[model samples]
Target chain A: MEGLWALISDDLPALQIAVPLLAATLCVLIRRPTAAWAVAMVVAWSSFANAGVLLHRVLTTGTISYVEGGWPVPWGIELRIDLLNALVLLVVTGICAIVLLAAPRSIDAEIPRDKQYLFYAVYLLCMTGLAGMTVTGDAFNIFVFLEISSLSSYALVSQGRTPRALTAAIQYLVMGTIGGTFILLGIGMLYMVTGTLNIVDLANQLALVGPNRTVMVAAACIAMGVGIKLAVFPLHIWLPNAYTYAPAIVTAFIAATSTKVAYYVLVRFAFSIFRINQTFDGAHSSAIAMMLGIAAMFAGSLVAIYQDDVKRMLAYSSVAQIGYMILGLSFANEYGLTGGLVHLFNHAIMKCGLFLVLACVLLRMGSTRLSAFAGLGRRMPLTFAAFVLGGLSLVGVPLTVGFVSKWYLVLGALEAGLWPVAVLILLSSILALVYIWRVVEVGYFKAPPEGADAITEAPFSMLLPTWILIGSTLVFGVWTSLSVGVASAAARMLIGGGS
Target chain B: MIEWGLYNYWVVIFLMMTGLYVVIARGNLIKKIIGLNIFQVSVIMFYVSMGKVRGGTAPIEAAGFEVYSNPLPHVLMLTAIVVGVATSALALALVVRIKETYGTIEEDEIRRIEADEDAS
Candidate 1:
């Protein structure tokens, strides 16, 4: 019985991916849209519980590596879970459940009734792909699941009524294709240099080879490829449009989960897939990261201030937020990694609440224009209140989730003696405050748009999840232990340091 | 042996850059898709080139065969082709939708429309 339990625990990682995937296919057959949504919600929460328990198990223990059918490394596929993936897995599932719970009423207003059932099904498949990408150790498995998620996301984004959404989806498809292709090329390079599919085996073999030309090329390709996916600075051309034109729920889900998962993959690749000592010596490494982080921070915030649309503004802010995460990694130290990881978790809560609130506003006002939000605080007080809190978090205001991440990041930058970066971070937060306050001012102070009376609150279903996450920003802000605790350990684990 | 050290990689790099340049610089929608196709095919060539071992035959069940071209990159390129094709098909389908909506297939035209819409 004990042995069987261990075997079952070993299978948990794969099941977490496979269960939702199988349910998604079954959901298509359930003709009733309500039933499909019910099934998707249950699956999301179940995955969340599974991920939660798995995270707890790993936190208590250490890394868990389960080879397919009990095969050892270098011979079979592996599902590897350390603190890093476990944390991301929980965030993915948790966000998915919250978004799905709030999806119905939002969809009723924005999406036509006929498309509702299929929407939930596609959402589940996209969630499965994200979970699979997080949980797997095989490089090729990443590509396969990446295509699954990308295809579904295109469908979801283009589901928007605006014809411009089609163009946005096309651009994302084009850029995502190139990104995926470059990753394939990089993985092929690694395979040529080291004849193993298992990540641990590849790492061990790579250490023996050191940094050769092929390995360098692979590193370059992988970095560039994933930089595009995570929407890192200059490579982030596709994100604002995709997020802006996408369906509200789609934006909410992708905002909270998609790019963060890519960041997790980047960490896994940088830390585990290719060990540190071998990687840190790359020429132009620090320069590229620092250059791009500064660019993204300054450019993303400045551009965000010019946006009339709330969703696009938040998307630019995301680019800047990712800059902070990358800046943290540029330090390549324990504290640096901790700051990045903590920010990843904090940004998820803050951004998700912000997007969901935008969804709420869109439901009532039929647009996310800055002008339309004027005096919104009076009409839909709770929804706008959530935005203010979330915005405050985005601007790194004291006692919010964003403040915690920035504080730790500042400490980390100081530890690294990159005082300039510390200054840039502070400056960017002020820039963020400028954009965020622009929205807050319009929402609270400006007079309501003409013919804008009879506006009301987002339905209970929608507001419920929005407030839940908004409340979490406050909860996590004060506690610090949930994000900072996991992030510190996860960061240490990421940089191959003592956990 | 000299051929192995020289032209094998140069050709691959040249072709890859050519493809990438087209994707970045071209304005026509179909041309851009064609450029993407070229970009993908060039990468496949790079992988195939890397997999080649001098004087090696295909890996087949045989006796006393000491050398074989690496089959792994070849295998990966197959999947890459499938993904590439899927992307192309979806992209073209979207272009069709764009043509329907805006009645144009030119990248610059599409941009002008989007800009004009945003300005309004």
Candidate 2:
């Protein structure tokens, strides 16, 4: 057993990517929905376990570097996982695994059975891309993985029942392609100047080069490119429609993982690779990020308040949640960066749980409209209870993960001597309250339409996963050692690397 | 004095902007995709041009040849071209489905139809 464990541990990085990718191909070949789902489920759980092991290894031994094909680091592609990506890897894979546990039931309702196998296959491929992006230390390899994930998501989004899904997918495709191209161009420019595609090497070379116009341009291009993917306020137009019209499981999975991964990339580019202050003329970039994040917080929350569709409201809320993460990043201090990174994990758990609640509602009622949620609190007690708990977390009430993340963010803001930013963070939590309360009122206070009594709770299969994530909101909220502890370590590493 | 040797970059910028403009201005899905293609091609051209040396042949082993154009960018761009092609193919496929379902591939028309559906 020890020998077997040793063998698996040696190839963890390669296995993280290859398992899903190869399984995705197997899913396509299987061509049976149940079989494909089983394959995807097994792969998701294994990847989750693999991510857990990788994070453990990183925490114990520090960064793990794997050189592909036994080639040298500067020339061959490398997979590097420091604390930052190890934390992100856990979030991505953990969310994927939990969401997949609830997927089969939700997927059955939204997608035609004939195409369900294709759905699972594409889902695994998307997972492959996201995991690859997290693990790769090569500059060009990030682009490759970004495209893999983007293309698969486009395909997944278009699988929705409504025709609007197609439009959403196309818009996302165009914007996403533009974003990918910008990244490609930036990588090309960096290669032109530094002649290396290794991220660490590029960072070292960039520091030595010291503020060339080409490097500045490269940084700007990569920032904007990742900004598009990150959906940082102005670039978030494609998000709402895509989420609103997508299949429930797709919306949950992507909402939980994709933007978080994109934000990880943004963190990497800003802190790890370009060293934000040095690249952007000192503190100007932070001001820009702060402004955008502030705008996103208010604008996203205000927009969410008016959305009649519950899924659309949550999607807009995702925009605002992304703001909190970015706001954490803008502070660039250890506490602030920890807030951002911890929010990445906290938000993934809560938001995914909330979406899973929607999936349960959709499974039973055929809709996620506000009107459909009337008296759902009485009928689907477990699911709506999950929603309320998740909503409380979103509102940053004490004893919830949301509160944990927000506390750190506020602490970070105060530490940075930006008391106004702290006040604004509190104010935005009120906005979150207004939107979440809107749903609560609809779910609890409003009367069910006539003859709505037959509505039942979501299946155990679905509710188990929903509550697992919802339960973790409280679990991690009280036990900050796992989320906040790892996050601060990652934040310190980033700050140390940057300086 | 302007460096005439840097003419390739000028072409790249022009093509890139033109492609971006078309992608933004065109309402037709197919045209938008074509614009995206143009935009991608500009980047590809930029990378390919960067790899070229002043007096280099294709990267190959020969007794007399000393200088060879860098093959890395060319190889990288090969992967990029494949990605670009995949993107276009997927975009075109989505366009086909949109046309079939919405009965029009024009962005305005699709929006109008969706807005009508939402109202009812």
Candidate 3:
């Protein structure tokens, strides 16, 4: 009850998680679609409001930690609101607001009317799960919320009203389970060495057991687990089909937020939660980081160039973008870490905008095939414009957010004297241009096949969100202050600060 | 024949890896689920095994005991078991759906369908 009042007192972190969870259960009891949506809207708005306040609080006062049930961590569950978690909280909650507002229409169209209320309930549940995972400081709590999200995600994807969606959900389920198991195993490894589940305590205890081979193996296991969850390169086999067959709104949410959260976990582990002890006894860490990251970059981009379906191409591109984030991380420098952080937020926006545009096109064109988008530039100018803005960001065009990320990345590579890596980054951008231009050429130059009638542009519900992100992509491109400042501060909190 | 804190961990690690390899190598979908079950159980085993302290009984507080198997990891693992159950249920549901759609539970056949899907 006190935790409940703490939320009422504007503690922010509790409100961020509790609002959606309580609202989700209440929504289920209501059993009315409109009422469910109203509740979900309130919950999402509150979550977003709470996230913004939390970000400001973290920026002003450093990390704000609350011990749930009034028990301190290592003995009880805790929530830590730091710059990193707050940034993620804003992105997650912000997307939830848009997805929820946009959901009723798409959900009714794709899902049966009878099942619409369940859809909202599950989506909100998944939102609560994702938010809880980010806010919680306990390793085991991460797993709990991770499962909640994955479980609901499978149900959401399976509600695609196509048989293929079932298969996609199965593949995702198998891989997600494996990933979760690996993470749990790694957490177990840490607990065996340190005897604590609190992330802060685990980091402190890691120093005494720093030299053990088990610790190194634990790191590798954790990396691989997060890698799979993020669909990093080779582990990305389930991605294309899953995104392709899923409900478009489901694709938009998962593509935007899911892998990025896992990527945050990986960065949290390697950079903040465990980096302190490594510097004293220079562990051979950089080698593994380089090996996995560069491989993901090279392999993911190459695969993306060959996909014919628009959604598949975008899915492969997700892997390539994840590669860039991972590559920046492997640089293990201040600039590299900042670039990585910037790319995380940038990728979320650009990818969601890109996928939302595709969702709009899917609504009109009846397929996501590149051939169908012929002359879309003329027919649906706004959608195509949003697509182009997103594509330009994808290709790292100058004076865009993508360019800012690449500029910092190239600097980091040069700082490390990794000239070859700088070249690979350039090459990957070319590959991105190739795939993006495939659609551009089809839309602008190619003629629509005979009997294909002009279709209406996607509704304002869809177009507005795409444009908001497109405008932000341009705004952030010129206004590097926000992106660069937050990223550098976050990098310090990750790499230099002990916590 | 009793050993120290380190010995207890070795057996758990060995079982965990063995389960992990089975999940990696197996191709049948149901068998993969079983492999995953073993894998998740191994993780639970590892965590619960770690919670054991030397000369500790169950974690409930009795007046005279100096050692208590850490209560936190145990509570956490109980939650994890619930997570594992949810994962298995979702996995099984997906498998059922895949079987209904593709008419095959073997992963190779599913891959063939996916490849066919891309080609067409």
Candidate 4:
């Protein structure tokens, strides 16, 4: 049993990807949608368990490097686990497990009966892709896994019954392809200069080659590509529609995981692979990123204020929250980077909880329009309570994970002597408060429209997962042992420099 | 002489810009997809060019062929080609669905129709 545990521990990273992919294939073979969902749930929960084990291993043993097929690094594909990847792996699989738990009931409600199994299969493929992207050490392999996740998400987005979903999927495909192509072009340029595709190896070579035009161009291309995927301010045209038009559960899962992974990729490239600050162009890139981050914070929130649809509003809020994450990254110090990394976890929980609450409301109300939520506080008290709590978290209210993230972010800024940036961070939360308060006002104060009084609370399954995530925002908010400790360790590892 | 050696990059950049132009300028969905294909093909070309060695033969493990081309980029390009094909297929399928519902494949037309629907 000890030996078996050792073997599984050594191979956990590969299993994290293989299990979900194998389950995805098994789901295709299964006839019943319920059976397929069962297969997915078991795989997802097991993956979550495996990810927890990996995180524990990393926390204890430091970095674990797994090379495929026993081939050494620089020759074979590598999956390296450090504190950062381990933290993200736990969050990604954790969110996958929570969302899958809530999926069956919502999938039945939203997806066609005949196609439900296919949705589960594709959903697992997406999980496999996201996990693969997070763990891989090869630069080109990141592009491959990126396409896998993006293609699966495109399919999942288009699965909704609305014709608008088809359009949204098409738009997403175009934009995503452009992003992927730019990344590939950038990769090719970097390879041309360094003659290597392995990330750690490329970092070593880049250190010797120093900064040049080709390297800067490569960095620019990669940044823009990831920026589009991360939905940084002006390049965020593809996000709101995709979020609004995708099916409820699909929106929930993708909203929680996809852009978070993209942001992770951005951090990997800038800090680990390129070491952007070491180059001559480092200050330029950081400045531009900071500018865009500030803009996205304001613009995404301001746009979120006017959205009539609850899902769309939350989607815009996600954009704003992504800005806060980016702002932390741009600070380039341990405290700032810790805030960024911690916000990744906090925002995923905060946003995913809110979307899951929206799923609950959508299941009961049949519409997510602001008007449909009138007097929902009384009609569906538990679900609305989750929403209110999630909204408060998004506004950075104390005793929530959002407040913890913002506190560190403000500290990081003040440490950097950027007082105005700190002020802006606080101001944006006030903006967040305004947007969230709009829904609260309507939910609690307004009268239920005609025929709305009889609408019941969401089913227990949906509310359970929603409240679990909402509760964690409070738990991690106060404890700070796990989230903060891990985030600060990951930040130290990143800022300490070198891959 | 210097410009001549860098001609491949020039051609690659031109093709890339043209493809992006078509994608951004054209309203027709099919044309946009074709443009995307062109853009991706330019990337494929860029990568394949990276592996090229002057006077190098095919990257076979035989004895007298000393200056061999890099095989890694070729392998990566194969994966990239597969990704491009998958994206194009998905895009075309979505375009088919868009046409079925909106009665047109033009971007502006779809927006206009949606706007009018929203207005009414």
Q: Whose lDDT is higher: candidate 2's or candidate 3's?
A: 2
State the C-alpha lDDT per candidate.
0.86, 0.93, 0.81, 0.90
Give the range where candidate 1 chain B is weakest over 10 consecutive residues by summed lDDT: B1-10
Q: Lowest-scoring 10 consecutive residues by lDDT in candidate 2 chain A?
A: A276-285
Candidate 3 lDDT tens digits, A286-320:
65666667787767777888887888889888888
The lDDT, on a scale of 0 to 1, for candidate 4 is 0.90
Number of the top-ranking candidate, with lDDT as the measure: 2
lDDT ranking from best candidate downward:
2, 4, 1, 3
Across B2-84, the per-residue lDDT of candidate 4 in tens digits comes to 55666777779998999999999999999999999999999898888878887898988798878998888988999999999
Residues A345-428 of candidate 4 have per-residue lDDT tens digits of 999988899999989988898889999889999999999999999999999999999999999999989988899999999999
Worst 10 residues of 3 chain B by lDDT: B1-10
Model 2 preserves the real interface contacts to a fraction of 0.86
Query: Runs in model 2 with CA error above 4 Å?
Result: A1-3, A278-280
User: Which residue pairs in model 2 clash with each other?
Assistant: none
Once fitted onto the true fold, the runs of candidate 4 whose alpha carbons sit more than 4 angstroms away are A1-7, B1-3
What TM-score does candidate 1 get on C-alpha atoms? 0.94
Docking class of 2: high
Sort every candidate by TM-score, greatest first. 2, 4, 1, 3
* lDDT, residue A74, model 2: 91
How many clashes in each candidate?
0, 0, 0, 0
Clash list (residue pairs), candidate 3: none
